[model samples]
Target: MLNKYPLWKNILILVVLAIGFVYALPNVFPDDYAVQITGARSGTEISQQTVDRASEALEEAGIAIKGIDREERSALIRVTSSDDQLEARPIVQQALGEEFLVALNMAESTPEWLQAAGAGPMKLGLDLRGGVHFLLEVDMETAVEQRLEATSSQIKRELREERIRYLGGDLSDGNNIELSFRSEGDRSEAFDIIRDRYDEFLLDESTEGENYLLNLSLSEQEIQQIQDYAIEQNLTTIRNRVNELGVAEPLVQRQGADRIIVELPGVQDTAQAKRVLGATANLEFRLAARQDAPRASTESYPFRDEPERTARLEREVIVTGENVSNANQGFDENGMPQVNITMDGVGGDLMTRATRNAVGRGMAVLFIEFRTEMEQEVVDGQVITREERVEETSIISLATIQSTLGSSFRITGLDSIHEASELALLLRAGALAAPMYFVQERTIGPSLGQQNIDAGFMSVVVGFILVLVFMAVFYRAFGLVANVALTLNLMLLLACMSIISATLTLPGIAGIVLTVGMAVDANVLIFERIREELREGVSPQLAINAGYSRAFVSIVDANITTFLVAIILFAMGSGPVKGFAVTLSIGILTSLFTALVVSRAMVNAIYGGRKVESLSIGGKLANV
Candidate 1:
């Protein structure tokens, strides 16, 4: 039989299995781990004393702290624990303060043998281990408005540069623009110029009286496309930022037409996660109110803007967050924790100019508003009486400016160390579209996760035993061979999943069970064919070869269709559906190998080059 087919036939199976195992080898190892500790309360900083205290506390709790290092505002501690004695959050938080972050089971921490073998802790899905999940809706309306504004600005700039004679028009409103030409012919020519030159920018256009109204509204289909593109871009940016934070298996993907879902499992600091996910770091450097400017004369101002007074003040933004180079947590001159920021070349020049002009005057105030639905309602209700009340203000000092701002600005006055750190992280993560409010939240304790793991393992064990027993009793010798192959197939599948960092959920386990049954079906098909050939008085080798050849096409066709369905599910599904698809796809591939190649190899080893009167056991003609 081996001599009859192409040598590449067996080699293809070998290569695939080799690739899968090679990819999976890394999942079999242990990992290195570290713990970061910091002060939780406001105005508190981590020092050597803090580190010493934490070490003592851990030691008292029967946890042996091996090495400890204290930086300016935080500490890094290293320790080891048995698999059953993993560190608990309460004990660590009580000792190191609520700001402490612990990272355990790192791949690099495993022993050399285990590390090389790709063994480590099991990966948990977001549903099992509570973390942060974000559903961000892209503001397509705002995007279109911005595009219109940009188009208007470009037109103004180009006309000015070209010295075109035209009347000024209101471009900010987007719906209408008036440009009185020098003559009727010039008006027509100007309209043609804009309509032809800026076709891509214009959504729709019409002439009303002497003005051309460019309808800047995007179509529904166009808006949907833009939303998708934005979601993809945001996903890439978020993925990169999360990777920089050294997180493992962070899932970032588009959830719907305009929303994206980000899941970060094992992220305990909800505040920190929110900061990273919500910051739209749209920094702006506007001139401060001058010292000689008239004061409000009272602590509170009316909600409605006093246009006569407010519009008289001169204000302009010199730069924005786009010019920022980097931001990090640091300390002010008074030894208070602050965010250290740096700017790029253009931003540094702009900042220097702005600072030089405002040195003797009041410092620039930073406005940070976390707008949620409730906040919006409150602001809107007071719009007629106290519109200004909606704005929140925090002031930084010249000393803080000098220490923390170097071609950049630090936003201080944070209520706590965690808050300050989170602010820094937000700046570092880049700006978000807008502040996100929690619509729903949930947390799963590690204890519950452990319980779930135990239940899932028990189910798999029981199912495996039942299937093995059933196969052996029903098909006799052939059943025994199939069962062994099935067992090995499971090990290989798990090894492959771990290697690829594919998550395993409960639904994924169901996929594995289904694959098991399907694998048996394939073997049953081949075995029954071989039995038929044997009853026709064919030799053992010829019967086996004919059976496999006849059943191969059917097994391939069935599994291929299933594989296609799994792929479709992966493309359109989320969360558990995705996990199910991943496991199903992997299982199908493994089943094909185990049912065809592995079982065949075992049979060849047992009955190769041997004459047999009958391929049956227990004299029942071996129900195949």
Candidate 2:
């Protein structure tokens, strides 16, 4: 009775193993290489016409598509191979146009029953799924300058509200704003206003002959905060874009002081990925310039639809894309495409104040875009190619203030439905705080990913077999029980990962291999302990119980330490290392359960409660 487990205990073990097997079953069903097509904006449905167009495009290209399935909002076109998947996406995109987003993805092929129970396959990392990895360098200087410009605009507004007239204020030396006033009183008042209201800025006043100068520069702490905010905002914006792309297990994290890393696993179309990730389009609402407005206070931009024509708008912004809470694309009463915009509470108040006094005045929506271009410059006699950020502004819409606008309003004048949809998508996802350029990009094809999968699988299989052989030969019957528990350990590990949707990379597979060895070591320790107990002239049942009872502490201690290390790695490491750490952490837990509990149960069933002299642990040590 010493080594015997209670009925409920055995039942609980069986139930756990059953659940593990159920959850881990989905991984056996591989995903289908497919192209997913969805509306660029919400409320657009997948119609039969769209499906026909996609099918026709694939057929004309001679790319064999397995089938087409249309859901309520999207359609999936399963292809025969990865080549077809890659080639079919562009063809479909060209056929469907910009109104629809055609993305290369892996379609789930799990059985309906398993899917119904919420069982999903473990997500593969970019290295295993063949996607795009991008290293983007953010323009931190541009971010700071943008902040300064906003601060300058706020200061100008504040001075005007206080009836303090300043000649002009300009962002000087890219670090601070310098204001020139005609009188010392105006400069002194402005300095006090800025210093009192904006604690982040360092205000200094100087007398330049007759002109009074007031300079406002951000404090070091404030600058650092701005930089941190820019990076955090960019990461969030990039994540939103990646989600819109419908990527699975995408990685978007800060790389360093001024860089970001994005890994889009299961996304084969790098062009689409790059376009979405690097897009820096934002919207600005400004009142149209009056006929007598000063040139210095107004800026001109060409129309997005009619570039030959230009419109001038006030330099002050009423609200920006950051205020947009939601946007949806729809058709106006005139049957032309339009975007319905919703603003946050703060934005709504600002819009109401800006529109209340200028009911009939026209307001222009400015679309600002930042693009990165390569320029060659001779630096130290070497021609170095550098990326230059170019800013382009265009007026997308100009309409009279229809009564008084509020949190919810509609913008018309979009050229096409596709343009309207794209604009709505951009606005809905929010805007990037600053422009980012891709400094490095790596594309992994599905074939290469398959190769990695094959290699990883082979390594696991080989390592597993070797561990099994060593365990079986060294300890005979107890080793066989360990092997059975080892198999269950793997199942439980996979189940845990799948349940949590963990991304498995090549290094993660390495962790699994390491887990196998550690599991075997645990069993080896217990078997050796049993051998020692038998040498001390203990009975088989007592030796078995003592071996397990004594080994539990060591197993728990060792696994706990390893689990701690894995937690630290996951916390401090990036994509690959994190993937490895996640698996190792999970494996440590599953291995502990199997090595101590499952193997003990099996050993108890094999040798417990009966009159036995020795365990079938090989060598003279077992001959007690």
Candidate 3:
């Protein structure tokens, strides 16, 4: 049993280790300075000509070229060094102009084939890579207001459908909807209608001086639920937005009750990030009023992109961007930039009913932005500052409906291809449930990230060397075997992380250090068990066999408990805490394998068939 690693077992172990070793090799290669050029607008495809143009521009600038690769979405130009990268970026941007977005990127030094096999280095987290960090505070007040507006629309629809005449409802007293009825009979009728159809609102009857008023407000529980949903939905929406930005690893999670923290790694263009992540924009398809209406800047709404003009749009929304399941930037029949939209079943039904009788009428694509503005007012001889959320709307495009469209449609009137792409991206990312403002913003540069890497690497090396030396001095030959196992365990951990594409943060590094201790601890348990057996005057071979068998259960139990804790931490923790839990979990797993399977296999292979003798651990002892 001491020499139990048969041909098949040995073969399996070798195969796994070899695979791990191969996958972990990419880390040895350094990143190269490169520039990536992607199409800035729809229908602006990059061909060989663009690549050639980029090459010529860089060559003219006297920059050394490493290679040029055409990717599915973008073209990459690899440069010789960082200096060459600095020289090539501006020149390429100039050649491409506004039609293409040129950004600094890092290409791996590993061969392309290895990368093609889906084996690349693990992604580094924001702390390790040093990018953008934003702490966003969700506007709870705006969330409630938005919900109230939605409720108001629903009430109007129901009242009109039931043929109950009433004055339009208004949001009064901060959170309640006050609906005025000229007659008591109509007020009672409306009460029954709302009570039967809507349980979300708590109704109250009151008299506003002389007019009959029905007060409608959401219950406390409903309001709290809506607020919670708003934060959760915004978290999901922000995650989608971050992904659309092509950031490799972004951290978007809820913080406290009404806040979110977003970390974007390896991002250089903060402006673009802000545009895609910060904008609270949506699309609305509405029927345009042909007659010109008087414009009021204070109470009236303005057009989306055109701020100077006003849009007298109907309050009833035909359909919203929320119903859009998919959107892509493309070109129309006349080569105009447009977004091809596909709607969900609900949206499709709404559109069909809306346009059935409205053919030949004008349909306007209105852009809406939920913005917050601050105003100062004097009350009772004292001035107080107030912040107000403005629902800004604009008619981006007004087109005559050619036919009754349902399910799918195209929106035109985008001024540029860039605008089309951006609008499409926003629609596809979905609308935020609540408005948010930046509470804190930070940017970490690549230089700082490199410094963190250097410092972290040095710490690991120092810790590993000290452990390696301690094991060697204490356990001698067996210590050497433990060291070999420790080294392989690390390689396996990294290989596993690369295979899973785990994000390695600073806390993850601490996990690796924790793994080093656990690996050595396992060996120490077995070695101590063997010493106890030897003190009883057992034969060396018997002691060795007993040492492993007796210690195996203990190792499994201890590691199992720790593994369970890691799972809990990972499930509940966020950001760097989760990162640490991930590496620690992987470490516990690999340590068990190395201590029980790997180290034993190596030890038995070396001294199993030879004359039985004492372990080199304690110097001189004879065989039984």
Candidate 4:
């Protein structure tokens, strides 16, 4: 009974190994290359008819497909090969027309039972899975212009509140606001008001004949602050959009002053990622312009639901999407699609102030989308292609103000529930502070990803085999026990990673390799101790007990230190570093369990409750 384990303890060990094996089994089922189709707009949906048409198109094009899996609003066409998938994407897109979005994807072949049990393979990193990478440049100039326009509107409201009169005011030189007054005193008064109220602006007064003009330019500090805010906000927005796309282990970070890098792992096609990440869709709430209002103070935009009908809205914006804190898609009392919006304190206050006295007036919600276009301009006989930012504004909804709106409201008149859902998603993700242009885009093919995976797999296998061979050759019987523990350590490590949904990168594989060596080192120390005890003419069972007991402290000390380092790395690092840290951390735990518990159990079962005159430990104890 010296080295025998309790029945419950043995049962627990067996149960744990069974669970590890069960969870890690999903990794054996490889993903299939597939084409995914979704609606291009909210009004569009992926119907069974659409899937059949796409399937027919693929057959007509002689592209082989394994099967088609249909969902509520999307469908996945699993193809036979990656090459076929690539060729089938465009064909499916053409067959679905512009109403649907077609992109390359991977469909999991995991059985429903495994998935139902919450067991799945580890997610691969971008470098291992071959996804899309985008380098986007922020339109800082346009950001400045938008800031200037908002500032001009604020200044107009401020001057009006102060009872100051001006003939007209307009944005001048793209960075300055010029306001013309009828008298010098009025200009002087306006200058004092602006200088005292707005620290971000530098006010200058000038005269042209009988007209008195006051100019306001943004301060350098304020301009820098705006640019910084724009970059930071765009980073946050892009991250939200990437999450909305359900991309696993995405990287969204700032690179330079006016650039951002977005990496979507498992996103083979850039179309959907680009459309969501780069979209500058925003909302602006403005009061409907009165018929007698000056034309210069109002702008006309076509209705989104009916492009033929136009609505006039005041140029003064009450609030924009930046004020939106949360949004959800829901149906109104009339069963029409609507978006329930929640605003921040500032936006709520602005809405309250704007609508407090205009109860009967109409408020319009403007949907603004900024799109990038290429323009060729001839300058001095050289035709230069330049990127242009095109602004498209439409009135999504116009409703009479029944009461003063507060922190929460609803916007209706959407074309479909899908449209409402998409709008809600975008608004919930927050608006980009500035438009982003794709400066570069690259797709890492699955072939390259497979190569990386093969290389990493080879490394792990080579390291594992070498460790196994060394342990078995040197320690003999005990070394073979350690080898079994090492193999179990790997299975448990992978199980932990898969359970936690950790992304596995190249560094992660390196961590696994390291874990294999460290695992055997524990067994080596115990086996060597056992040899020393046996050389002193001690009984084999007693030596085994003493070896394991004495080595536990050192094993704990070493693994504890390594685990702390992994925690720090995970806390401070991003992307690949985090991936490495996660695997190392999990490996440390699983290695400790295998080295201390599993190996001990195995050693006890092999040599427990039996008298042994000699052991098979190598070196001087080969026949001890």
Tens digit per residue, CA lDDT, model 4, 1-624: 888899899999999999999899899888888998987764556788899999999999999889889987778999988789889988988888888888878888989999999999989999888899889888898888888887788888888988999988888985789999999888988988888888788888888889999988887888899999999998998888788888778899999799999888888756566556767677789999999999988899999878999988998999998899999999989899999999999999989989998899999988888877888989999999998778888998898898999989998878788788878888889988877777788888776787899999999999888888888898888788889999999999988898988999888889888888888888888888888888887877788888899989998998899999999999999999999899998998998899989988987787787776677778775233
lDDT of 3 by residue, 149-174 (tens): 77787678678878888865888876
- Residue 584 deviation, candidate 3, in Å? 0.7
**Candidate 1, residue 228: how far the Cα is off, in Å:** 10
Rank the models by lDDT, top first: 4, 2, 3, 1
Instruction: Please report the candidate that would top lDDT against the real structure.
Output: 4
Give the clashing residue pairs of candidate 3, or none. Answer: 302-393, 303-393, 303-394, 304-394
How accurate locally, in lDDT, is each candidate? 0.59, 0.86, 0.82, 0.87
lDDT per residue as tens, model 2, 506-531: 99999999999988889988888888
The number of clashing residue pairs in model 3 is 4
Query: Candidate 3: misplaced stretches above 4 Å?
Result: 1-4, 33-105, 137-145, 166-188, 195-229, 243-249, 254-258, 287-314, 323-429, 437-440, 531-539, 610-615
TM-score of 3: 0.76
Residue 258, candidate 3: how far off, in angstroms? 4.9
Candidate 4 lowest-lDDT run of ten: 615-624
Which predicted model would earn the best TM-score? 4
Q: Root-mean-square deviation of each candidate, in angstroms?
A: 10.4, 5.9, 6.4, 2.8
Candidate 1, residues 466-540: lDDT per residue as tens digits?
Answer: 889988887788789999889878877887787677877778878878878888889888888887877777776
Model 1 accuracy (lDDT, Cα): 0.59
